[model samples]
Target chain A: MGAVTTPKQDRSRATRQRLLESAVACLAEHGWAGSTVTVVAEHAGVSRGAAQHHFPTREDLFTGAVEYVAEERSAALRALPVQGRTAVVAALVDLYTGPLFRAALQLWVAASNEAQLRPRVTELEARVGRETHRIAVELLRADETRPGVRETVQGLLDMARGLGLANVLTDDTARRRRVVAQWARLLDEALG
Target chain B: MGAVTTPKQDRSRATRQRLLESAVACLAEHGWAGSTVTVVAEHAGVSRGAAQHHFPTREDLFTGAVEYVAEERSAALRALPVQGRTAVVAALVDLYTGPLFRAALQLWVAASNEAQLRPRVTELEARVGRETHRIAVELLRADETRPGVRETVQGLLDMARGLGLANVLTDDTARRRRVVAQWARLLDEALG
Candidate 1:
């Protein structure tokens, strides 16, 4: 038999989804300090009690929200068109330089100092990082067993992240484009 | 005549130096929020009035502190022993994966959210970044006029920073060592 979708259950699920989305928005726009349950509940237009019932504490809320966002980002990365090497590099650059990165940056900074939040953030970051690496490998059709291939992948990801960090403070669009293009050329030479 | 060092002037200079060092220590351990003038002054074994006399405001304090730290780091980088490529890479890795990077990470996170701090942080970061890049270029003995040499320099710095970011939450020492070795190999291949 098919699963039943009762109105009350649907409403509960919708409320949880809203809270998660609101929490990510808060993190992206106002950073870790501003992403309180009360703020998220208000942003989601839900009652504080409802938000608490959905996510018992700030940790629970952030943990759920990061997982939700990571899944969304993973799916988006998987869906990217692999037309050519340049295209793949550009898409990865766009992905790393976007809101997902900003939201994750907030968590990274907060988790660096917050002992209670560190384990969860580290777990989520590792899972998401692995998935992204896998996607990049697949997109580039890179041979994992080849000498220097894995390091190249690591280097590319690290370069993207560094550029994203620069973008956090300055308008590094032109420089980022140039760097990506040059790296893409180097990758092409290496992998060809 | 050479500038005369009065006892009062010497004491004032020492207090300021202590405060700056304390500020960097607080940043590395506690992040930006805990690196207040009062906290730094206390950490330095100085009075709040003395801290204010030297710094005037939190912005001034942080700005001066960052500049002070950057100059110290620059001198340290210039003095690194040039044993070989692996040794240079290891030293660079050690430089990035230390307290300096942690303190800078705190400022980068704070500057991302604070408009008032953004300009100062951005300017200082750019200046420090250029100096670091110049040092890396010198260490690598890279030809700046070469087509891809500058990008290679930039790539190395960016990769170090990205690895530093990863190290903030996880013990990425093993992975960082592997990446640095692989990158050193690639750099040798390219530059040789």
Candidate 2:
């Protein structure tokens, strides 16, 4: 009985998971103005009532959604197999080019101009930013104790985000590949 | 009278300019949902009818506004004096940190999800992107004809945008300065 859940509880858990995933997807595909709770509920294959049960208001839903995306990204990062620098850089860059990044971007834009959503996203950002930085340091085997090294690692991350931003409006593939490959070499020189 | 504007035409031009500037400011301060034609009209000290006369619809206002921003930014970039690499990098990064960047960012997020606004922003982005790249090439004294040199320069611009994204919600001054400085050193190594 220690880890067992009743069927009723299991069903409830599934519904909540679906809601969170669908909310982010909806937000990514449709801006905040177009993505409504009902839209999300329909996307999740759950009733609006059930979605409301998990998150009462739009703010509650987005707050939960952002946390979920962060957890998923961190998990994805940790699961990356230890690899060569080029492969690792490519993988890290991939993190910012996907749907999760798009969803987070929407939230960031929303948070910037949204008063009610600002504090929560800001708090989440600080936490997530620190966590990602620590993970990057680990993955890069970056010894930030060395002068200029910390900023180098951060510069790499910022470049990754910049590449991601470039991709937002159009397919930044061919050019992005060049930039990514070039960054791997830079990482070698700068990290050393 | 060869190049001079008539008084009535000058007033109309001023009102149009005011509307464009106000729309961007409103978009930056308040997300797309909160920023309305009426709101921008109020901010610009123009009557709603006057704003409507200049911009028939919300899309018209945003399209015109985004163009105005791109022109302003390009003009600002052209006005920068030839400077040291660090100063050049810092100035380029500054272009992405201020209100114009904020306004453009909101439009990007909105356009990503709003199909109606997509093509126009995409067109403007490509135009503005190419122009900025050309300016950066000249300012950096970057010889892109060299292998990998083009990507190196592009990387610097993307890094600047990424730093701007990081600054959207919080003041990223301290870390940003470090990243910008580090890129200056990286440029010296990579470009050479």
lDDT per residue, candidate 1, B1-192, as tens digits?
639998988988898889988998888887776678888989999999989999898989888878987898788889997778777877877776788788888888788878888899999999998999899889878898988778877877777778888888888998777778877877666666
Best by lDDT: 2
RMSD of 1: 2.0
Model 1 - which docking category?
A: medium
What part of the reference interface contacts, as a 0 to 1 fraction, does candidate 1 reproduce? 0.49
Using TM-score, give the best candidate's number.
2
Model 2 clash pairs are: none
The TM-scores, one per candidate, come to 0.93, 0.97
Residue B133 Cα positional deviation in candidate 2, in Å, after optimal superposition: 0.5
Q: DockQ of each model against the real complex?
A: 0.65, 0.85
> What's model 2's overall lDDT?
0.91
For model 1, the chain A TM-score is 0.94
> Which tens-of-lDDT digit does each residue in B1-192 have in candidate 2?
549879999999999999999999999999788888999999999999999999999999999999999999999999999998789899999999999999999998899987889999999999999999999999989898888888888888899999999999999999899878887898887876
Q: What is the TM-score of candidate 1?
A: 0.93
Q: lDDT per residue, candidate 1, A1-192, as tens digits?
A: 539988998999999999989988888777786678999999999999999999999999988988888998899889998679888988887877777788788888888878888899999999998999999999998888988788788878877887788788888898777777777887777766
Worst 10 residues of 2 chain B by lDDT: B183-192
Alpha-carbon interface RMSD for all candidates, in angstroms: 1.3, 0.9
